[model samples]
Target chain A: MFKELNHLDELSRRKFIQYSAKAMLGVGLASTSNNLWGSQIIGKPTAKSVIYIYLSGGMSHIDTFDPKPGWEQQGPVQTINTNVAGIRVSEYLPSLAKRMDKMAIIRSMTSTQGAHEQGTYFMHTSYEQRGTIKHPGLGAWLNTMSGKTNSTLPGNIRIGGSNNAPGGAGFFDSKYEPLHLGDPNNGLPYIKRHQSISEIEMQERLAIAQMMDLSFHQKYPSKKVQAYSDVYDEATRLMRSEDLQAFDLNKEPQSVRARYGDTKFGKGCLLARRLVEHGVRFVEVTHGGWDTHNDNHELVSNLSNPLDQSVSALLDDLHLRGLLEETLVVIGTEFGRSPKINVNSGRDHHPKVFSCVLAGGGIKGGQVYGASDESGHSVAESPVTVPDFNATIAYSLGLPTDKVVYSPSGRPFQVAHKGQALTGLF
Target chain B: MPLSTPQLRSFVFGLALLAGPLASPAEEMAMEEMQMDAMMDSMQMDAMHGMDETSIELFDAAKAVLNSYCYECHGATKQKGDYRLDQKSTIYSPGESEELPVVPGKPDESALFKRITLDIEHDDVMPPPKKARLKEAEIKAIKDWIAAGAIWTDEDVRSGLPTTYVEIGDEATNALIDKINETRAKAEYNAWGDNSVRVDLSVTDKDKLKEAIIGLKDFGTRLAWIDCSYLELSESFYKNISQYQNLERLHLDNSNVSNEDLKALSDLPKLNYLNLYSTKINDDGIAALAACKSLNKVFLGSTKVTKAGVEKLQAANPELTIIYK
Candidate 1:
């Protein structure tokens, strides 16, 4: 029984599991509930939540945020003013350009890891891919630090990403793991039980399973075992949760849906907006196929349309409901493509210099931070490293990046691993 | 693609064996030792190239110390040594001393940076012998600030914030205001620049929401935005909420707020965004809100608000964006 639930004996049908203990492990195995509580928040946070938009493949900076016009490296892509004076982006982002007053573009993002897997892992966890130990991603750290504001819902969610994606609850408590959602359009798969299986029978099966694995789990007590057991408990609670409507895209009106458009990416954006609106701490929506190694211009232009439309609508909708100030909308990628146009008229992987964007969350708007050279080949001034960029994100959430948490094996690790935040961005 | 008998085993059967789930603890410890050594070497390499502090961070710390301690003497009011540290230009300008106050990239040459670190026994040490001495941390902050280039940051965005409705109210009114402000949502004033007040209650509890909201009627004048979207009972709960003259953005989505409840909001001059999604409010509600000329965006999703009702609102306020579905 929760210490706070004495007054509320009967659970309401609408708002179930508002007490966090019921939302996590304490509900299932009630015995081993001591260490599974969410950490009390420490610092005064700037952003209450974050929407991490991860572009899985390397997005081309020269063709997007950093348009090097008149320089041949820019290729055939035209540039337009971004409403803010002296700032211009690719022609494809006309809608975003008009609302540039709400965004800050970082043009000199550089990274050392060039391959897709390594770079993606590095960006997510802010550390090199080491064989010895896995590191927790930003989501895991966030839940571990402040807990979830919406205690009934999952602490964090990742939409449109691989099931075995990098930056999961690595080496962290399994309760802090993100609920991997494959598509915003689809409901939580297998959330409902079989019609024939009675509730009592399901509870019996779960108890028997817990008893059978009790000894083995106690003997080793590894992160994997904790994660496995906790996942089952999470799903059982989630199945009965009424807030499950947060996942159902159909709840949004058709007009609202049409404004974001028909692409899965657009739906994913709308889902991100809804989840954050419900007080979920962190949400990451991954949009892939950005690795434009061939037919760069056409492929990027096609991709840019959905990205522009959905993000613009998302920004507008958030402002409409007055959520833009506290919700941090971030556009991040593993790395950017090469500046040089290849024989296939496509750009290859280039980790030397790229671009990312930040908006809302107390960030200064209508400004560009750092810059690449005229040809967009290398960082010319104020080069921001991958860890530094992520550190700024942590800073917005009031996360103490200097404080280190020890892994299971007692290895020290910080959120961004000693990366200094760009304080001026605030 | 048929599976063989050997390949047809249940996943539970395979997992029950527990083949040391991803490496045993002993083996992990053994492997981790070698990795730690390699990581130590990398840490040294990083130390050679990594920055201790960025220029902006140094300046932020240094200026904070200056504003806290030195500002009393060498600030807007009084400049004891004919040195004003308020403006960036005045900070760099040479005062009585022949040495420059700040040398940008070279902090060792800057007189301001040097004075704070000078020996207390010396006559020129900052804060003087009679005043409180600077802490080691404060000195370090000053050093780092100068090392990163003493560039000044502009912090003028916090001006023109909303002023309080009552400057000096009665004890009962002030007490009522305090009670209303208990746990009210607030903007991140420190991050935004100043202690400017901006109220937002987008996500609040439904426990005593009725009484608490009725309480807001006393001091609700400060609120421009309030969201009652997901609450269970949002019907005539708008006791005195409609009379809140400064209510700019209001969300009663997925509720039972009626036409009469919205009718009182028709005269608000600054109401910009209103969301009445999934509510029982119909054409009468839209008609009641038609006089809101300042209304810019409105969401009527899943409501009985029809095209004719929307036309009535738009006809009165042409700039109104009616998202009716």
Candidate 2:
């Protein structure tokens, strides 16, 4: 069953990139597809799904993953040993510490962009931010590569919210954009019709709109206009399909929900798990407020506690369900915090060296791929660039990083912008 | 002025020190590394503002080397293995093997570097022994050209560079540029043509962070600048940076930069720009920024920076700026 589905996905992926290229350039999709025959899927896929947990604002690397316990740069936060020998995390992350054996920590994540917007853009798209065009995020790229696993539901979803979240399907069709859920408890909204509008009435209204759109679509032939109809059709399909239940978090047992936690971020992670289980290809759960300029200890403590719980529960749940091997869970941020705590007891953004935790999805856990110096300042060994990190994500999913796909204006762009996958992680 | 042969030898020796400051004395440059240094020396010529008489001689010498050993099989006439040595395009293009022959800005990653510099008895050595071999100087010239972003044209590489490129165009921008040059830090602009800038102090040695900040005071009326990412904190650095008024973007990511430093920024009328990303800024600092009316686009990604302070700041300056995470 999996092989058949994967074969189908491969066929669609070929068509999608071609269709996207042709649609963007107003060229022939078939010819473009022929040219791109050898462009994608260069490796065997290790992951069927991805759960990207973005810790918005920079998390303190010195305080969290690459902690320097007795160093002068060490903050008020203490360190604790994890289940994995020699691995440690912030004292606040008690839950994550216990589950460290299940994770592979990359402590030497580096980037050129330090500001939030640019760094976030770089992190998600594997390209620098430019006013000229919006590059597709990893989720959008994944959706383009593997196609949708669930026909009725969106392949990509963004839970909770952060300013300038890199969730947009930049330059791609709007259908690829993440289905943003501002509140997890709220679930997928506007799925049901109004009480006054009967099913027949809705169908009649859709029929009329479709008839009107058909003539206009033929006359105008605009991709945007076509996307409008596609969105409406998908929405209509979703409203009637039973798969829409995946977005409804209330469907989970109360104990399971509690296990993930009652907080918005916790619920978001839980919802992400359900969506992935239901065949959503990509889900990004964002937890904000890691800036920690002032009151760093108090603020990080609050965020880390929930993060520790939600992420641990998600990993544990995935493992128990035998889904961990197929699911790639990534905990990332724009960058990391400064090693030096400020006068107000806060750390600043440090991109020189940071940390990210990757779990399951063919990753060898209980191992650290890279390290920082004694002061946790620069990358000590195995420096991983932002593109390298994103390339690893692509690698796990068997997405081709070297494949060059032309944008709307005929500019060739790679999946991870020249970043080689950290094959050592697998 | 281009260095003469004697000066070049001394300069090459100097570079060996520059490349391995942390490396031990006994571990000197390998033969391949020495070849790379010669190539790098030639590449640095591209960054020169003008072509001096000696530089012309150097290029001519390199062209001569190419003519003597490489021109017969790979030149414009025969183009053996579809690898043409005459034109820049053929040299840069991948050969029949479908791998890049030369990777710009990195000779170490280039295939040409491996083949040409390989041992004489190696199977992949160029010139095939049937032809004349590449001399030591010729090999260095080729390596240098590839390393220096592989410039093919005679035009000075830095000639058409815009004002926003890393070296900066005018005296006003030079302050930050000169200082960054002093330390091992990297200064970058948003794009090849864009004026918005990002200067990273993280690459520099830890001891130079203070000096790097002191140099940024020369950014003058520039709108955006990123300094102090992962730098060890000093109170003096903050005092120097707060003096600028035309500041649009400031990135003090992950340093010991504090609320007091933020308070200094509040006085700059045009200084609503603050990137306290993962820093020590708190509710008081966010509240304190109320004095500067243009405070918009505060990224409180990690709540530790804002904690419970953003709401009060928002209420006070509803019209100031409202973009939040």
Candidate 3:
């Protein structure tokens, strides 16, 4: 009996140390408990949150933020000076112009990949795809760095129909992947309590499950059993968290909804803000159908109008609420449209030159950091690469972009490769 | 496809006999190992076959829904929130926050499950506010993940297993406010804004706006906006406003500044906006604005500048715009 007691004590001590380490690492012990225990950890920044907005299909810089008014053959580009002096944007973005002081536009972005998939992967993960190894996207990197703050809501959330390229926590393990919303276009489903099941019944059922799991846990002393047990506990906590209120759009005022517009993109933007407001560290909202290979102007006008209104409203709303300063808003595309108009009166995908915008966090706003050439063809000054853009964002958010993490294969990789932060923008 | 009790018994007896011989080692062990491998493979096949067809169908349907609707934004191709759903293991668990996506075996506890089931009044609804809802069956599959112990395994293989920054309560809020104020006082400004100007509007009782401005002031140290639209400002207030010499952008757009005050503002070298828009200012005030050499753009759209006064101001400062319309 004494020997058994000592054995039990040893096991309990091990368990205590394991739990302590997991608490220190700031990650859930249900999944990674086996590997994380007994590991010496490094300290990172505490701004463990991210909000990603992917402007799927390429957003045209020429017709949006970077209007080349002096070009003789400028394509339907009209310039309007913003509140920020010496900063002029396309006339289509009047609402954004009013809030220009909250954003930074990069005009001289250059890339080498023209295809949508490649450019999308490059922009999302800051690494050119080599077909050999898949890399994790920026959101995955943040989730890995910060871990989860709540055991209920997903650590990373991607709203809308689908996620972007290289968005998963590749190599880091499948456990770090995002929780994709099944469908967000129609509306939320089945959140109400069922009339058939009384609250007492629900409580009784939960209690029964807890008791069974606890009994099993007492008999079984394996990581697998513990993982299941912990998951059950987490589920109970999630059911009780008031943070569930973050998903309710009706909670927002009517004036706020009208300000965001009555479009899909607008609603997604509002949801993004709401999620971040609830302390969801990373939330990615995608606005798709941007692939304008033909009839670019018509498509851009149709799609970009809503996007402009929604994004502008989001920025202004965030700024007014003071969330913009801590929340970094990025607007970018896979690549850019061709400088020269094609035979179809549209622009083809051109990776050589493009544009992207950054705002909030510690970035300097209302300033055009780079310049395109006279013909809107190539970079004329301070060419910004995809890595540079992402690096600057990570840097401004106080994330260590240069920190290296090894892959499962023992190969070292930095959050960004060979790219410096755009110090001029900040 | 049901097995007879006698067949099952015989099978167990045969398995025990085979194991008994293997326990002695040597050639029997090798033979038994081969048989065991085959039996194990068959058992796996049988287990797969035994899975409820409805559950299998639901799982496939759920996967299809995820691929069609969610993979675009949260799959291996793209992870908007550093999250992917291509694999089962990447489900939400506590990371930096206390939030987890799906708490397996408890649909009510799983945020993913709840988010999908949330009403319009809840802020954490899944599929987002704009997107379509999952099919009834798809929702059932999400619920299934919770029922299945929220396992992160491909085959439910038991073998693999793999900041409170804001505290609650009134006291905590007050403590947080005090700490925040102290930090704000000590916060450094790097070419953004001057920190010396103590614009104490805390006593105004405007909680949300005050928090916004304070937060902005803390992060964006160099930027300041003094909207004296509704505030009753005295002579000393204007003097204090003018003292922020490091002010890069100022919005006195609809302020009650007179020609005298406009003259006083001309001394501000960095004054970007001298918006005397619905205020008492005439062509003489426009002429006084010519002293501000750094004034690149001005909004005098509804001002009192006559055509001749505008021309006079334009002549003095060709870069400036004196509204006549």
> Individual DockQ of the candidates?
0.03, 0.01, 0.02
Model 3, range A284-342, lDDT digits (tens) per residue?
Answer: 77788777777776777787777778888887665544355557888878877776767
Docking class of 1: incorrect
lDDT of 1 by residue, A66-112 (tens): 99897866877899988899999999899999889999999999999
Model number with the top lDDT:
1
Question: What's the ranking of the predictions by DockQ, best on top?
Answer: 1, 3, 2
- Residue pairs clashing, model 1: B58-B145
Winner by TM-score:
1
Q: Quote model 1's iRMS.
A: 18.8
Q: What is the lDDT of candidate 1?
A: 0.71
Give per-residue lDDT, candidate 2, residue B114.
72
True contacts kept of each: 0.02, 0.00, 0.00
lDDT value, residue A382 of candidate 3: 91
Worst 10 residues of 1 chain A by lDDT: A25-34
Please give, for residues A199-249, the per-residue lDDT of candidate 2 as tens digits. 999788677656544544554343433454566678887888666778888
Docking class of 2: incorrect
Q: For candidate 1, lDDT tens digit of each residue in B1-325?
A: 1112232222223333332353344234423432442343233222222222354466677878888889899999997767888776488787776567778678799888788878889888887777787889998887776676665653211111111211223355435534544433221112222222223344333354555566666554555556666665554456456667777667777656878888767767888878887788889878877787788878886788788888888888788887774
